[model samples]
Every structure is written in structure tokens, then in C-alpha cells.
Target: MHLEAFLYGGVSAVLAELASYPIDTCKIRLQVQGQVTDDALTAIKYRGTLHTLMSVCSEEGFFSLYNGFRFAALRQATYGTLRFGIFFSIKRMWNDRGGTDKNLPFLIALGTTAGVTASILTTPIDRMKVLSQSTAQTRKRKIVNTFKKTHSKGGISGLYQGIWPNAKRAAAVNGAEIPCYVFVKDFLTNTLGLEDNMLTQFYCAVTASAVGICISQPFDTAKTRIMQQKTHRTDIRVYEGFFDMCRLTISNEGRRALWKGAFPAWCRNGPWNIVFYLVMERFRKFDQWANQRDHSYF
Candidate 1:
């Protein structure tokens, strides 16, 4: 419910996102590659972060790097708004529900509530982002060229191809992230007696974001893999559910298989989330820009 926290949150996530785009692409690619006789990471040599970007550009095209960028940017901005907007508002409502921040278990509640809300509200947008990003650019099927192909797969339903697992990923991330962040932020402020100002909020938020990403990274691996697959992969049935994804990873590759593109995920999510939250907090407190300003479709 703190204004400073809200503002900082948005900034934190956005900065992190731009920085992590390459890693994000790598993780998405690795996950979608599906069953692995060899670990996707090891096979690729785990060479620095940009291997996926370089590989995609070499194999696909330059535009492939930006395949879903329009959708992703919009999604980030939109969810960023709603998440901070709603999270703070809701935290306000329930603030009265507890005694002190620690006594109230506000962190867990914040995580679950904000996560669920962001998951449900942004579900469609995120689905589109995944759909667009997952589909690589081919000679004939560049981004704009394949717009029809993307929707034509299953009409409207195709966009939400793996909605269930997406929800699980969302729920797990938000459920753990939101609450953990709040609690840690609280702990830092209340226990450590740090000033409940912007600096403190920023530090706490960064820590919370890191923790949340770590908790739900596995689900993220599974979720991205499921979405990034070609619609007609015969051998991809193994990645049907979230839990199924884990088992499939182990069976096909090894326990480390579940960690496909783990490095990029950490790279992409960890810092990006911090920026996202930071920027979001700024938007909420100081500046009053209307959400979704003149930008929707690419």
C-alpha cells in the first residue's frame, strides 16, 4: 500500500525486462524445444546469455528477436499498471484485516491476491504474448505475415493453448512472490527498522522479486516450453501439464532437464521483475498517466 513501493516496482520490472530480453528468448526457445536426449543447455554449450539470440538470428532472422515484442511490451505495461493499481488498492482494503504487518501474514496474502488477480486479468494478453513469441519467424512466416497463421491455428482458442499451466505458473509466481515480497519488505522495515521510505521499499522489493523468481522458475520453464512448441509436434504430448512437464523433463533428459534455460530465466526474471515493480510503483504514486495510452496493437 505504500506509494513509493508502487512507483519503484514498475520501474524495477521494466528495466529488468529490457535487459533480460535475450535470456527470455533463450529460455522460451529451450523450453519449446521439448524432449531432450541431451540437455538443451549443455547441448548449446551454455555459452554466455546471447546464444539463443545469435542462434535465432542466424537460423531464423533478425526480426525473430523481436517477434512478440509489441505484445510483450504492451503486456508488461498493462499488467504493470493493473498489478500495482490493484495490489495496492487491495492491500489497503485488507490492511484492516491484520494487526501488524508481521502479525497479519500480509506477505502471503499479498502474493496470492496480486498473483491471482494479475493471472486472471492479464491471462488473455499473456496468452497472446506467449503465442506470438513462441512462434518463430520462418522464411514465409514472418511476424506480420503469420498473424493469420497464429490465430488460424485454433481460432480464438488457439491463443490460450496452454492456459491451465499458465495459470499454475502465474499462481505459483504471484502466490509466492507477492506475499513473500510484502513480508520481506515488512521484515526489513519493521524488524531491521529500516526507514519505511523509498530506499527501504526498493531494497525489500528487489529481494522479494529475486525470491519469487527462484520459487517459480521451474513452473516458468515448463510454461514457456509448453507455449513455445510448434502446434504439431508429435512428441510433445509429454509436456501436457505443469507436473507432467517436470516428469517429462526428467524422463526424457534428466532432472536437470527441468532446468532448461534456467540461466536465462534467472537473468531475465530476476532483475526485470525488480524494474517492473519499481516502475509500477512510480506510476502509481507520483505520475498519474492513464493506463493503456494510445498503444494496443502493433
Candidate 2:
């Protein structure tokens, strides 16, 4: 189960989620903008990330920024824990079979595997999050109501809507994020002969955040749109699936639309990467120290 990996990943993810969630809310709001299907949502023009943050606070109150936070936190705990746990578990197995940590391909594969697995398993929470965040923030909505609405609208499939896009986004994100962080950290520490410290970790996290955001933003945009689609409205279908969403978005809004909310995503991801990797590394060091102490006692 790689319990330690799961524990560390959950803790790091929840803490990171807390720190970056407002930016995340802003990102979601931006991504859903300029979409044809968003007519059901309140029409609030957000100029940019800052504008969105300001507009949301002015109109919806400050706490509106943290709307759907419970779902976000739960999503992180389940998806984050599973992804990290599975990644490290597979990594350990591969190492036992004489695989090298220096292999970039293996790291990417592990990340993709972990991300897809986790995203699939915890998709309901993700759906609820999108539903809550993409709605008109003018009205205070309960997270439980979001769940009930989804189930009533489409049953289990409703909760699983956008799973494919979510999975792709997760795969892209984790594939880039964890591997970039690990690779950069390894290069700096092992090749450059730099000590493992906060500075080095910071550099690695920044690189990873940039790479991850670039690779995953499009899928993230698509996922948000798909999940935000009103299932109750059978008269209008905005998108059939992930590729359709991308095509329509590009055709209607231009290629740049795919990268919508990218700045806010990066803003959220930068701190998220730093916090996650820092905490993860510290947990790993503690685990190693505990193992060493136990071995010495033995």
C-alpha cells in the first residue's frame, strides 16, 4: 500500500490545497468563462486572475473564494494519497527488479499510472468540486446539495462525468510534476554536487510547477467545462467529450482559449509544488531516519 507515501502525500496535498485553493477557484472561474455553454452560469466578466479574485470578493464575499473547499480538500486527500502511494509503490517494485531511479521514462510512466488511477477512483469528489466552483457564486451553495444534484441528474454516471478529461489532466500533471521535481532535484544534488536544502528544493519545485501547468492546463480547462456542463439540460450539448471540448473551444475561442486560466493555475501550482515537495521530502527524510534507528537497535 506504500502507507507512508500515502500518508505523506495526503498531508502535503491537504496543506497545499489550503494554501492555493483561492487561486484555484479563480482559475476555475476563468476557465469556464467565454464558453457558449456557460449561459446557465452567472455572467461575470473577469479581466484576469487578479480581477477575478477581486471581482469574486466584491460580489460573492471573501469566503466565496473558498467555495467548494471541502470537496477540494477531500479530492486532494483521496486522489493525492493514491497517486503518490501508487507511484512510490510501483517505483519500489521497479527498483526491486533492478530499475534505476535515473530513468526518466520510468518516472513518467509511474506518474501517469498513479495519476490516472487516482483520478478515476476519486472522480465524484472532483465532479462535485467543479460543480460547486463553476456555479454562480452569488448564492451560497452547500456541498451536499451539489452531490445530491449530480446523483439526481445522472446517477453514478453524473458523478463520473468528465472522468476522462480529469484522468488526462491528472496524468499530464503528475507525469510532468513529480518527474520534473525528482529529475531536477536529482540533477542539482547528484550531478551538481549541491546539498539537499530548501533552496534546491525551491528551484526544482518551480521548474516542476511550470512544466506541469503547461502540460496539463488544456486538459484541466476541458475537464472543468465538461464537469460544469449542466446535465439537466438535454436541449443543449456543449461538448461530447474531451476532444470535442478542445475542438469547440479552439474553433470558437481560439487556441489560446485552451490555455485559459493558465496564469492562475501557475500561481496555484507554484506554491503547491513547493509545499508538496518540501513536505514530501521532509517526510521521506524522517522515514529514512526512523528506519536507520530501528536497524541500529536491531
Candidate 3:
């Protein structure tokens, strides 16, 4: 079950990433737009999701929107694999140990644990993805060059920038996303007397995505700023830590800055979640069918 969960999660995540990556690029750009304190550049470059999308397409070319595609896809695969796999594995363990009634809190705890573990393990790839998509210069830079530069600045630790905020963001996202999906699906099926079909899954995924984005946006904003900040010395970063990042952003860019790129994040994650749940649900049904057929054969 764990292996199957990992496989389904990775496959769905890669496909979802491929489908929604341009929006993600736009989100990153918007999140890091006014990070610099230059008075001349204080104006927001990317006005919103549509404007950012149009600007990137026109100025940087359409393909540039997929900058750092490989890094982001890899991060999605590994992180998605572990998060989903661990969540299901732990749930199975809980069920075996007389946890027959899985409540919202129980599922949320599992999802958060899985998300934190995956986020910590894959923070470097996430850092690279953010750095690669944060600006026009980074959009053209290769991941190897980015890796070398980051390594030069802070050795191995450089690549793991923003791990704290990233992990927190993951916890928020995962805690809300998967649990909401499961809870909503169950409600639709058992309470509302709806069929467990694609329509139900679609509704559940959209709800989950919205909840995840709302909960995670502030942390996501901080993580992007911290990861994309220009640094000469690793010890002397613009934002010392997660709280420092939030404090500086609120002070310099206004409190609203904590939710920067939130719309774009929802646009990206909404489609991503829909695709992920659809694919994962299909795979699960197929696996169940296959197991049943094998048992009949035996």
C-alpha cells in the first residue's frame, strides 16, 4: 500500500506540476517582486495573476514561464511521494491499532507529520525552484549554475535556505488539503448520499485546494522571499528567520505582503489539486479492481 501510494502520488504530482507550473512561476515572481528595498523599485512589477502571466509571456517568452521546470517537478515527485505515502502508511497503522474511527484531527495530524517530513527532506530542491523562478535573471540561469552559486555562498547549507518557512507552509497545506479532501469526500458520500465519482472528487479537491492555499499563503510568501533573497554571507541574510521574514515583510511591504501571490497560488494549486486527486483516485480504483481479480483467479 505504501509503495502504491508513493507511485500514485509521484505520478500525479509530476503531471499536475507540468500542467500548473507556469502559474507557479508567476506566483513566485509576484511573491518576490518587491523584496528589495530600493525606493525606485518599490513599485510592484507584477500587478496580479493575469498581468504577471502576460508580462512573463511577452517579456521573457512563453517557455520562460516554465523556468526551473525540472527542479520543481523533481521536488513535487519526491515530496509528494513521501507525504502521501507516509500519511497513508500511518493511517493504516492507526487503523490496525484500533483506530477505526478516523476523525478530522487524527487525519490532520497524519498529514502534517507527512508534510513536515517531506518538506524537510526536499527543501533544497524547493529552494532551487524558488531561486530559479524569482526573477528574470534567474529564469535564464541553469539549475547547475544556481546550485554552484548557492553552494559557494554557504556551502551545503545554502541550498536549504527557507527550510523553516517551507516546512511550516507544507504543514499548513497538507494539514488542510488531504484532510479536507477525505472529510469532504466522506460527507458527500455518506451524508449527502452522493456517488463516489469524479464529480465528487472534483468538488472535494477544489475545497481542499482553497483551504490549503488560505492556510499556507503567509508561510509560502515568507519562504519565497527568504529563498530568493540575494546573499553574500549565509549568516547575514536579509531575513534572519521565519518570524524575521514575516516581520520585515509586514514592516516594509505592508501587512498585505504576507499574502502576496495568494491568488496566483490558488490558481496554480486549484488545478494541481484537481488533477492530483483525479489521477490518484483512478489509480486507486484500478488497484482495487486488479487485486479483486487476482483473488478471484486464486
* Winner by TM-score: 2
TM-scores for all candidates?
Answer: 0.75, 0.93, 0.92
For residues 130-229, what per-residue lDDT tens digits would candidate 2 score against the true structure? 8778755656567678778789989989989999999999999999988888778778998999998989999999999999998999999999999888
Tell me the tens digit of each residue's lDDT in model 3 across 1-298.
5577788888888999999999999998888877644332356888999999999999988998988888988898899889988887677677667773238999898889999999999998899888778767533666678789888887787888888988999999999999889888878887889998999999999999999998899999888888876666444337788898888788877899899999999999999999999988888788779777431100
Better of 2 and 3 by lDDT: 2
Cα deviation at 36, candidate 2, in Å, is 1.9
Model 2 scores worst on lDDT over the 10 consecutive residues at: 289-298
What's the candidate order when arranged by decreasing TM-score? Answer: 2, 3, 1
lDDT of 1 by residue, 1-298 (tens): 4543344545555565666665676677766554562233224432445777787778777767666666666566666555655565566555655444463455466666666666666655676566566546443334444445757775655566667776677767777666666677678877888875667667766676677676777777777766655555354343556787788678767786666676677677666766655554555544434543332100
lDDT of each: 0.61, 0.86, 0.84
Specify the highest-lDDT model's number: 2
**Model 3, position 23: C-alpha lDDT score:** 96
What does candidate 3 score on TM?
0.92
